[model samples]
Target chain A: MINLQPYENPMYFGYLLIGLLPIIIGMLYEKRFRWYETLFSFCFLVLIFDGPKLGQGIALIGYTIFEVLLTWGYVRYRTRPKGANKTSIFVLAVILSIAPLVVVKFTPLFDPQHPSIFGFLGISYLTFKVVGMIMETRDGMIKEFNILKFLQFLLFFPTISSGPIDRYRRFIKDYDRVPTKEKYLELLEKGVHYVMIGFLYKFILGYFFGTLLLPNIEKIALINGHSNVLGLSWSLVGVMYAYSMYLFFDFAGYSLFAVGISYIMGIQTPINFNKPFASWNIKEFWNRWHMTLSFWFRDYIYMRFVFFMIKHKVLKSRIAIANLGYVVLFLIMGIWHGETWYYIVYGLFHATVMILTDAWLRFKKKHPDLLPSNRFTKVMSVVLTFHVVCFSFLIFSGFLDKLWFGFR
Target chain B: MDNVRETVLEILSDLTGSDEIKANPDINLFETGLLDSMGTVQLLLELQAQLDVDAPVSEFDRTEWATPNKVVAKVESMQ
Candidate 1:
């Protein structure tokens, strides 16, 4: 028995490539070895959770069973001869599906030493998939439920840990059939390229920023600026940029691996990053950064909230409704990250900035002469957005908590 | 169908603050910065109100509804 967190090291990819070789060969011949793929996924799942993480392994199994039953029950109820899609049942299904994740998130607050038995790595990602299914089911989008396909989608080993969060419909499209020979070859090439980039981003750049530089900068900041209010220092600035780069490379790198592996298996998993730092506005930044997650929030949370407001006439002014939508969306995202003041503040901060950005955009629209849309302004906006994002990341890093309150 | 087209174009023009929506029926509203998530909501609401085409937000696939012509077609289909 061995435990290996996904994409944890370069060597892990060696093992991954070896396991995927068979699938790759099969795809080249325009065939899919479904049983072999299942076996490969099972073995990898064991390698990831069988050894020291047995508790989490057990938790994963139990969680999957519970979610499958819950989702299955919902689908049955919804499709049962002129379905009565009651809002109460839908809400209850969503809450029950997220209950384990809630417990896992809140466990530390109540008992610091023992994590919740319900806790496991990638619980949030799994919960996202489940909730998405439930919502789509409510909308009559997922009309039929098959246990095997649902299991495969939920436990797609490559992205089981963290995801570029593929949707049920999207995943099934690729899984149900093998790609054409040309398309499979193209996917294979892109998959290899993405994995190489992941190596560079995670092993080289992410290592430099996160493992080597971040700690030293943090130490200097603490030592130099502990006496100062809010512990501000030049080194703290360094920490901000370094941690932001590290965060991007590390998560983006992991996302690349997930997507690359998925592509190798003929599932065109959605990408998670797309030049996020180059974004010229907060809105654009979110659209590019950790894209799948943000898109999920946009589609599921923000859009839904806005529509709810409009439908219920919760507010008169559309601006106020949109602004409140940002608040709710960001606050939930912040709380999703953790139960910490810094995380909550990070969410609120984004919400505030989003509101302000909307105001600026509206004002610019009104007086186009005041804020000319030109190359210089575009570049400046990118620089400004970059720094704003880094500052938010600094808040997100929870280093400020350690600096001010002497705890992380 | 013509009425639906006119109504949709009117809404698109108002939401995007540009009359060019009627000129380029095949233009991608999203890529051209004409429609976004917010605009999509407004578009759906308008369609529901004016044309009685009730497409839910969850079913609004961006790709399928990207262009003005496609939007017009979709609205007509829903009718």
Candidate 2:
């Protein structure tokens, strides 16, 4: 049994202070707080008290209340005639979505262990999805929402933990239609399969490979370096391949399990992956990989950035504009991932590679006759892209210090 | 001369990487696999660039541009 003594952590009192005060102030002033804004405040209170048990309880209660309020507010707001004022709402939603990310990402600098300031559990995913929904509503891509549905969307338990990054339209449409008994059975079966897959990946594959295989291989490579550069490179590549596969299965398995559970609960969630490794190009890989997250970025972030650039005359020259747009998009992406210089570098590295690859493809298309149509180029591009992706992952693992200091 | 049909067919060929445009003038773009959402965006950009006409992206209707014939007609009307 888990120890309950930690529940008495002083942090609980801090959370009580941080969580309740703003809520009271907001209520007194009748100022609206976005769902995440309210949750963040509560998380702060929990962090102050250092009571994980109390924090968890408060988080559950707080989220339920926030969901209900947001849902009700959404319904009431939707009843008003469409107007130009939606732009302000969209902007507000964007800021609220990005706020938690900023706080959590930066918190490691102040307190690296807990990082409770940002409220890690599902806040990032929910914030992005909520922001996307607001954007979709403003863009007229989705019909106005009702309160209960909105609440359900926010606090939908299966996806609340780890998401397939559902879209508002898809979620609402599926929610409105009740699934048949047969469908429930089918979904339950799928859910079980997903749970099994998640367990296998997380416990068997990820743990075993990471603990049993990687360290020994690394040790061998370290001892024989320089004399066995090729061997070391190949081994490193193998390790990366294992890491990449582990990450995909672990995350994707969680998403699949979430979707399966939701499906069994009579909510039809969208699939998040479609054989990303089979992709022929980086663009295709992105399209097939972490589809929901990428789509969220595309719909709400990338497209918005592109439109802003176009409107502001920042995209005057083709090459300059493409590069600039990519940098901006990836920088935001980096910030979204975390506040560390490592993530920033990770984002910039991808942006640079994507831009250069795009430029090269454009050039090749323009001068088809001059370009080599050999199998070697195609093979090389795939190999190079894979290595580039692996290197980025290394930076993400926070092992740059080790790389620099030669410390094992 | 079938100017609208010819222009659309040429554009479709480029997009689908096909020499022949098998799509019917009245068929839905989605039904014919001629356009998905990404393809639709690409088509819009191409149309704006090639025809020097502004299409309000905000007002884009899937049904209105569901077919090459409808798209061509829309462009012609705009012209």
Candidate 3:
């Protein structure tokens, strides 16, 4: 039995390119082999989850079927003029869609000895897609739910593992149309370029930062930084920068591969990262980093909460409502990462910084003449924001937890 | 309608920190990054406070209120 994780190694790309050639050729001559594309997607899914990972394969299939039924049911109900379209029903559907992922997330935290039966590697990403489907249906954004299309979107092999989460309508637009000859050629060009960038980022630089430098830096930090007992040392700082680079390169590399492959398939899936390190503020950093997920959080969680707060007159101050929304959104996100103190702290740290940034912006608004915005100040702002973000990454690395808790 | 447009643009420009936003009446506020859902909340409040018109969030569809002009018309209709 042969199994391949998507973009796990260079050898995997060799197989991927071979498989993709037929699709590319078909696409060039104004033909899209839809059936073959589905088959191709399935074969890759099998290679990733079959064999020793059969358990996860079963879990993914069960999860997919469950999502199909739930979302399709909601869609059918929504289109009915007299059918029940209550908010409670929508909320119930949303909860059911995400219930599996919630169980998967909580399993290890409570019972370290055993994981959930419904757990799989990309369950979280799948849940995001399904939840989006349900929410959009309730909002009347999605007028129809084509089962086959939903399945294809849910199991889109390129982005199944981790996502730059694509919207159903946006994805359908690209999927349902074959690009013109000129446009296909452009996509081909960009696809190859994105893949090459992936190679540089994942194969070369990711290897250097994550596999090579990260462990060494971590060891030095643990040995020296731990001795301080107060958890402040240059070695600890070294771990922060190294881990941040490793995290950025590794994830960005994977996203490029996913997005590049989607482009080759003529689906213009969104790009995930946009030079996040250069952001001069936390809000801007979020827009440029793991963008799809953050934007998903922003649209679904943060904004929705603010609307709810204002609708009910729950909070009197607009600024207070915004800050409150940030706290709840990040807290939920923190819990989603894992049930760990470090993860929670990482979330809280960002929320606090964002609140500060908001307050500072408000202050700067009142004192426009007092605050300067020269090229030097712009450079300084970027530098300062980068370090503050790095400090948050340090909390996220869980190294401090290991240094403090694991040692003692 | 002109007064309504000026008020909407003023609130939007102040919220987004961009004076240039007021110039484009037909710009898709959400897509152009001039306005977001949070900005929508503020826009609704300002419309109510300044113009004595209620633009409820539930009624605020992106397509219906896609621009400053559309917003002005929507608010003016409530009068």
Candidate 4:
């Protein structure tokens, strides 16, 4: 049986307080600080304190504080009214947020013995959030920042780890004042439901599949050896299913817990999953699964790359450049996931599939009258997409080594 | 005679695999299922590529890209 005790980290309460500190600080400094600015400072301080080591913590906290202050200072120098210098602020924020990720990913080369870096808690998610906020501010979508509101927006605990990737504009508009007695009661009830579902998925379904089904199938494959080809094939397929189930249960569980907590707090965070397994194509699958992250890539990475390609006139052909952009975007995505050749290959694989699918659709469009509207095609697309995703996951899980090394 | 309209129409025709662009100037891209959110990104890229313009894709809200009229207006301004 899995141990629940490990989940109860002693620092858990401290982390919650750290998450809430920004809001409190923002409220207290309402006169001088924009609510969001105060919250940002609080978050910076918390991040510094929460660092794995004193030196690393001090450096990260100092860097973030300096960046935030520098950004605010630049805005102030412009002498523009509240939301006017949004573009400059956003540019600075993105650069600053991305700096930590770049340093961490590259640090392994310098210190191989201690490959792990310190002081980053949900840096990936924070980078996305900060970028999204800056973009929204630049677009003139958000006018004013309240410190408490800003803190609540940034450090909403549920999303701090493995986020549903909330956008700032959407979140701010959706968030209301904290709940009253009746509202709190309703939130508590819903929060309990979500927590129950999350716990069941993680403890029951995920654990059972990981412990029982995966091991049993592996054993069966080993016993049968190459003598029973059908058994081996079935075992591989079973392993894929187990992996897929584990991912869904794990992520969906986290999202449910986040949503439930937010709802009680009077925030209506958008639903993250929508039966992604039922998607009919790669395009549909992207729409359904990890919707927020996909959207982020679309908005910030893919679209920008496409625009840049068009602007530079480097490629004579638009379609060719667009296809290349997709590959580049996915490759960046792979690198973002981790520093591994497997990740790069996995990214390239998905990018190739997505590009080919898109090209096929384009071709079909040109000769539509020649094509038939058949259910078989749809079914085939769905099956192919699922396999593609599963294969990518296999690569992600570092299982291709087993295939190449003869299953020792 | 403006290539802007023709270019957009060609792109739309290619995307939807239908010659409906010539038939309707005021068709709702989303409601008619010609362009979902992904399609919108594709369309923006196509417009930038063909038109040689730098229209910020972020600024192209759904309401603005819903019809040919708005699309034409947005493209013209960017040019």
lDDT of each prediction vs. the true structure?
0.91, 0.61, 0.85, 0.64
Best candidate (score: TM-score): 1
Clashing pairs in 2: A10-A49, A11-A48, A11-A49, A11-A50, A12-A49, A14-A49, A15-A45, A15-A46, A71-A147
**Order of models, best lDDT first:** 1, 3, 4, 2
Put down candidate 4 lDDT per residue, A1-408, tens digits, no spaces: 111111233354245445444543433332223455445445534543453444554654454564455434443434455435654555766677677667777787677666444435555776677666555555445445555555556666556656778876668765654445565556557765876787787667877776767777655544554665333566666677777777777777667766765554445666677788777667667767887788788788777667656557777776787788778878988998877777888889888887887788677767878667789876786788888788777677554445444557
Q: For model 4 chain A, where is the 10-residue window of minimal lDDT? A: A1-10
Q: Write the per-residue lDDT of candidate 2 for residues B1-79, one digit (tens) a residue.
A: 2775577667766775544355455666655444543455556666777775566444355668777678888877766
lDDT digits (tens) for residues A135-172 of candidate 3? 77776778887988998898998999999799888899
Worst 10 residues of 3 chain A by lDDT: A222-231
lDDT of 1 by residue, A1-408 (tens): 667889996667778889999999999999999899999999999988987999999999999999999999999999999778998999999999999999899999999999999898899999999999998998888999999999999999999998989899989988998889999999999998998899899889999999999999999999978677878899999999999999999999999999998988999999999999899989989989999899899988899889888988989999999999999999999999989999999999999999999898787778868976789998999999999999999999999988888853
Per lDDT, the best of the predicted structures is 1
Instruction: Give TM per candidate.
Output: 0.97, 0.71, 0.92, 0.73
Best by DockQ: 1
Q: Where does model 3 exceed 4 Å of error?
A: B1-7, B10-37, B44-79
Candidate 3 B-chain TM-score: 0.85
What value does DockQ give for candidate 4?
0.25
DockQ of each: 0.73, 0.19, 0.27, 0.25
